[model samples]
Target: MEEQRAPGQWWRYGPPWSRYGPPWRGGPDEAEPQHGNRRPWRSTALLTAFVLIGSNFAAHDQPHRVPLDPYARVLLLITSLLLLWRHRYPVPVAFGTATLTLGYLAAGYPYGPVFLVVAVACYSAVVAGHRRAAWASMGLLWTGHALVALWLYRWLPPAGDTRAGLTQEIVIATWVLAIVALSELARVRREQWARERADRAQAARRRADEERLRIARELHDVLAHSISVINVQAGMGLALLDSDPEQARAALTTIKAASKEALGEVRQVLDTLRASGAAPRTPAPGLDRLPELVEQAAAAGLTVEVEGEQPPLPPGADLAAFRIVQEALTNVVRHSGSRHARVVFAHDGDALRLRIDDDGPATGADAGGSGNGLAGMRERAAALGGTIEAGPRPDGGFRVLAVLPSRLKEDQ
Candidate 1:
């Protein structure tokens, strides 16, 4: 006994019984499948040509056979028309057209090119990922053909010869097998291409996310350091405006310089985003600008002292070291209450080490406090296989120490 399929399983295994609802509708959790760039008109034109050719062949080849009645001709036309919707509902269309072709054949209509519609419909089902439906339809079609051949051999005098009948069946079977093989091969190739396209899209998205993170880090380092300096200088200028005109004028000059530098750095970042083919811009700030940074800190009422001999560092290490010092000093100016800060840079064998300490009262900045500056500094150091430690110093103020390889392994 054949097992009966459930209602929901019928749509998966066989053709839909009705076509009243929207063609693309699905359940809330299921998305309707999209057939991109499919040209239904091409299939329609091909099938229409097959119908005409088959009709003419039948008329010429079977002159003694009775002509197809109006109803049989109409059924053939309807089967051909169903090809128009094959791509949208491939399984249903294949089954429907095959059944209609069987009906026309059983009505004793003269043999014609009606099998072309079945072949094309089976191919469409396979391409749409309905392999089970394609195979089932092909089985039914082959069985029907075998039954028709057997009946013709038993009833008709000329087709009754067993040798001729077997030869014809063999030829028909070979043609059907060839069509199924070619369609399955085409379906496999299409699936492989789709997988490759999806993989490429996923990789591109990952690269975009990484680039966004890098740009964010650059912006944070630039703006945080500059804004801290400007804030300190502006506050100093306001305080000394009535007390001492000379010091207030110097403070205003420092604020202007800090703001100008900040604007230039910001413009460089924006230019990189806007113009891909633009000429090379200025190189990033490094330890060479340490003295200017120290001067700016001094002008901001923080007494900063620098000690050590700078070594020839890799470009990545140089930039990392500069940003580390800049962020450390910026925190001192903005968060720490003490005004005295010390920066020490040293090349210890294979590693370059930097330590920035300030004798300021611990103002919660040492406890991983309220910003991304400390996190940014740590990230810069770690990117070059380095480490950074920032916290409150025992019996004193906050301290930051970063160690990095003087030369990267890749450069070596």
Candidate 2:
């Protein structure tokens, strides 16, 4: 029975790329939080310029704050440069930017876009799966700023500065909340992209595996049946080559026809692999070709007698039914001592019943029996939500009975 996928697990089993495999894009997995060797030079430079020029304008309005000296400008440069390593060392950059911004405030520098650097670093950290680190860094920076604004004003530069107001504190707290919320949003988005990619990769693998198994079943049925006939006819031709040339010629003709038909079917299967997403040149073999199967069995010295009227079936069930019958007769020819076989068909409501039996005391011929014949038949039946029972009958014969749904599940 096919296992059902659990809820929330999307098994796309996607398109033609299923032939080879998915195009796997490699990068840092969960074990490593780093973005792997990304160069943040351009963005770092832009942030540095924004902070420096923006701080000069901000310093104009803050009458009690210190002016932008060479040391203050140097500190701002260092803070922005730290952002370049955010993708490679997100935790360090997050903490380092927060610490530097806190120091800049303590030194009485004007409040401007310095927090922008901290925000970028923390955002990178959170998106890299280091949420705790980013939260801690932002928390510490906010705490230190609160301390300086409420109590540490006396010890700071640009003297005569008074303590900040309660309203200002509320505004600062809200600003910090907004920054953290934005970072969390970005982190969630990144995680979602990763999950979707993983889903696609899994889908590709499953589709490829299914396609391989299906092709294997087709090739097995085609080659096994045709090769069994060729083996028998070749043996006969060899024995009659000198004694009777006309009979030998007839055997060779059967061999030639059987091999040509087999090659055409094999090529049809191969074409699916060579050119995916194209329609097949020839329709797949089904019960419409049952006469050919019976004739081939006759050429191989086995007589197949049909007992019931063929029933109408959907495409999938029809193909499976043909392969099952073909494999059963092939087995009879290769392994059974009896030259006579009976194929009976009956319809039981929505299901079609197939029974193939050979009147035999077992030949036990191990030669050329791949041992996968019964297994293949069983798989074909099970695929269409059906059952197969193939075992030695109590009455000294081999019986293979298959119950297949007339309509496939997909068709319904």
Please report the candidate that would top TM-score against the real structure: 2
**Could you give me the TM-score of model 2 versus the true structure?**
0.87
Model 2: worst 10 consecutive residues (lDDT sum): 13-22
Q: In angstroms, give how far residue 301 of model 2 lies from its true place.
A: 1.0
Model 2, stretches more than 4 Å misplaced? 1-36, 366-369, 408-412
Q: Give candidate 2's error at residue 122 in angstroms.
A: 0.5
Over 4 Å off, model 1: 1-39, 58-73, 104-113, 151-180, 347-351, 364-370, 382-385, 394-396, 408-412
For the record, the alpha-carbon RMSD of candidate 2 to the native fold, in angstroms, is 10.9
Clashing pairs in 2: none
Q: What's the lDDT for residue 406 in model 2?
A: 83
Who wins the lDDT comparison? Answer: 2
Candidate 1 residue pairs that clash:
none
